[model samples]
Target: MNYSVKNILLATSFQHKISVSIFYPENSSNKSIIISSATGVLQKYYSRFASHFSSLGFTVYTFDYYGIGASNSKSIKHITANLNAWAFDQAAVIKYAKETNPEHKIILITHSIGGQLMGLNAEIKLVDSIITIASQTGYWKYFKGFSRFRMFMFWYVLIPFTTPIFGYFPAKKLGLFENIPKQVAYQWRQWGIHPNYMFGHFKNTELYFSTVSCPVLILSFPRDLFASKASVDWLASKLTHAKVDRRHLIPADLNIKDVQHFGYFKKEYQDSLWKLTETWINENS
Candidate 1:
């Protein structure tokens, strides 16, 4: 295994310097993999998981979102949390990965929101296979009525009226709005009006899954807020691919605890996740 860390500039004016690690299995074929993080999480979060894939003989490229991880970017505003920005981040990282490893087939493995953005673009042939864990589908629209009133106060009134005079306003404990430019927060609030975190205006998570034509493996937990059992089944039905596999992991049969959202990537429980992931990759590729 050979490892190197470097920053790659993205066309979206985002800094996404990721740790590009390469591995060569004595008898393995050449393969390239890119792992993008969920929103606000850095690329390093997948260090262990990247190591797992690499051990299985993959040259892995993992990077953070615009505002998160090693890349430098304008301060993360509320708007950056939206799906559009996330999709941009994904496109940039994909381009970077292709440039770095032109000879290999590129596959994507992501967690949560990373899966959502993959759905938005409708560009599949570029990728060989995709694996998503605890990824969600559909709207958070349950908040629509309560959200409209808040948006009026924040964007139409607060940001427009207060920003120039106050220079900034407080956003949580992080001073996000005040410390960051008001424009960023304003955009964020505009998008936040929807319940869904990313791609709020889209039809549903299942609809997004339907648009995907490549081999996709979805792992979701019932305890997870987004990927309910029905949602997983809905996605499976829409996949259209006879080979796409969907699995739901619940907690111990003792019923003491439920499977966690992100913990599936951890070593303790990831044994099964890895086995299934590698099998899918090898079989499909």
Candidate 2:
């Protein structure tokens, strides 16, 4: 079950060089996976998950969006990476994987904002299937009770006020996430206030979703504050042409107390939730 990891720099069409890492088994196979990270999160955060899939005999790839992680060459304050630009970086990685493993069936595993921006990729049809983990629209109203209030403060009060002053989102200082580019932060803020979230801001949103016909597997955790059930449902409803399978995970089912938004990627859930993910991928692939 040994695997090898290598760091790569992918060149995007927009003249940006993105940092990417590939994890592959000692003996390769015809099935490969691309792990697209959530907004403001680095590629290294998903190293363990990529290694797990690599051990399962699938070639796995993880990359950082432009102006984040290894891809951030200059100061984020000077970068203008928006959602579309991030998608271009993602599409470049997907294209590289497709060309490198021409015989392999590529499966895209997206987390959070990764899923929301999938429609922006022009090379999306190269993907054979998609597995969205805790992916949802970012409309703040989707949250109820205290969660709604917290989101309101976060989107309305915190982001608008701080991002303008800081030139970028200093989420790292708050232990929320890696520092985000200004455009990315502003675009997210715009979505947070919109009724349809990302769909409301993305151009030709309906056409984009309609063109994605590959089978999709949506995974969500009940205790995940950000991607609530309603938000996940809203995303699923957009992909009308895709054969979608939705699964909700409860910590109790795994004999645990809590599995929050980022819990599924943690090593502790490898035996339970991770195994379930592998099983679903195997069955669907």
Candidate 2 local lDDT, 60-147, one digit each (tens): 9999999998999998889987888898988898999999999999999999989887878888889988999988988888888877
Give the deviation of candidate 2 from the true structure as CA RMSD: 1.4
Worst 10 residues of 2 by lDDT: 199-208
TM-score of 2: 0.96
- lDDT digits (tens) for residues 117-181 of candidate 1: 67654344467777777665433332134343443455556656665664433443332221333
lDDT of 2: 0.87
Model 2 / residue 47 / CA error / Å: 0.6
- Candidate 1 clash pair list: 7-17, 79-188, 138-205, 140-196
Report every candidate's CA lDDT: 0.57, 0.87
lDDT of 1: 0.57
What total of clashing residue pairs does each candidate reach? 4, 0
Off by over 4 Å in 1: 1-7, 10-28, 77-82, 141-211, 232-243, 251-258
